[model samples]
Target: MFWFLLIGLVSGWLAGMISRGGGFGLWGDLATGVVGSFIGAYVFNLIGLSAYGTIGSIISSTVGALILLWVIRMFNVAPAAAKKK
Candidate 1:
């Protein structure tokens, strides 16, 4: 449990840095990372790939977090696009 949270925090912060945005702050990022870890695991499994060890886990979660953030941004943009039309 503790390791999961720590990994999530690290992955979230790393993803935020890589994605180039203000980020969701601490708690938000933690939530994002926790969810993203699941997402990453699922996606990797779907692709018939697996990551080994802690660093691998972080990379996987970071990718998932970026995807999660992108989806969120896309939804936010969709409404504004509708409004513009």
Candidate 2:
């Protein structure tokens, strides 16, 4: 439980740095990390891949967070028509 939280924080920070330029603050990053953990596990299962140990978990979570950020950006982005207005 405790380890998961720590790993989530690290992975979230890393993902935020990679996807954007900085983190989304502590609580935001924590939320992203926790949600991304579930996403990562789901994705890995679908691909028949498994993450092992702490390092793998971090990597997986980071990847998931990146994906999550991308997805959020996609939907939240204004349409070209709206942008021009």
Candidate 3:
């Protein structure tokens, strides 16, 4: 539980930095990062990769955060496009 919160906070901070002001508040970011961690793990598992309990896990979580940001951006842009049309 503590690990999840810490990981989530760190990952969320990184994700927010990478996204260039695209993320929400602390709680929101934390939630995103935590969920991203799971997503990353699932992805790694699906592709026959191992997400162990170390730095590799952090990397995997960050990768997942990147993917999550990409997804958020995609949906975020949709409304703009629709409004323009």
Candidate 4:
């Protein structure tokens, strides 16, 4: 559990930095990272990939976090665009 939390925080911070040049604050990053880890595992499993240990977890979480952020951005854009129409 400790390692999981640590990996989530690190991965989330890294993902936020990579995706948007900064983090989504501490709690937000933690939540994003933890959820991203689950998302990463699910997606990777679907694609026949597996992540192991700390490094693997970080990589998977980062990829998942990126996807999550992309989806969030896409939805954010849609609502605004719909409102304009």
Candidate 5:
């Protein structure tokens, strides 16, 4: 549980960092990032890629987190002209 939380924080921070540097604040980024970690882990496992418990695992998780965040951002970004129309 504790390890998961730490992983969440790290993954989140990394995700936020990779997401174009500074749109969301720390807590918001962290929250998005934490959730992203779970999504990332799930996707990774589904793809038959295994992340061992090592520095490499952390790196891969971070990459996965960034990917998740990117996808989420795309979904959340409403088309401005569409909104007006």
Candidate 6:
């Protein structure tokens, strides 16, 4: 549990930095990272890839975080575009 939280925090923080400027916040980042880890594993598995260990978890989380951010951005843009039309 401790390792999981630590990994989530680190991965989330890293992902935030890579994707945007910074994280949503400590708790938000942790949540995002944890969720992203699962997402990443699922996504990688779909492509027949698997990640292992701490480093692999971070990588997977980052990838998943990027996807999550992208989806959020898409939704954000859609509403604006809809309002314009």
lDDT tens digits by residue: candidate 3, 2-85? 887888777877788787756668897788788889888888888989977757777778778878888887778466568667
1 or 5, greater by lDDT: 1
Per-candidate Cα lDDT values, in order, are: 0.85, 0.88, 0.79, 0.90, 0.68, 0.85
Which portions of model 3 miss their true places by more than 4 Å?
A: 21-24, 78-85
Ranked by TM-score, the better of candidates 1 and 4 is 4
Backbone clashes for every candidate come to 0, 0, 0, 0, 0, 0
- The reply for model 1, stretches above 4 Å from the true place, is 78-85
lDDT of 4 by residue, 1-85 (tens): 9999988899899999999899999998998899999899999999999998789999999889888888888767466668667
- Between candidates 4 and 6, which one is better according to TM-score? 4
For lDDT, candidate 2 versus 5, the one ahead is 2
TM-score of 3: 0.76
Best by lDDT: 4
**Candidate 4 Cα deviation (angstroms), residue 23:** 0.9
Clashing pairs in 4: none
The segments of candidate 5 whose C-alpha lies over 4 angstroms from its true place after superposition are 22-26, 54-57, 78-85
TM-score for each of the candidates:
0.83, 0.87, 0.76, 0.87, 0.66, 0.84
lDDT of 6 by residue, 16-71 (tens): 98887788799989988898888888899999988989898888988887788788
Tell me the lDDT of candidate 1: 0.85
lDDT of 2 by residue, 1-85 (tens): 9889888888889989998789989988887887888899899989999999999999889888888888998888687798667
Residue 34 of model 6: what lDDT? 90
Q: In model 4, state the lDDT of residue 79.
A: 65
Per-residue error for 18 in candidate 3, Å, reads 1.8
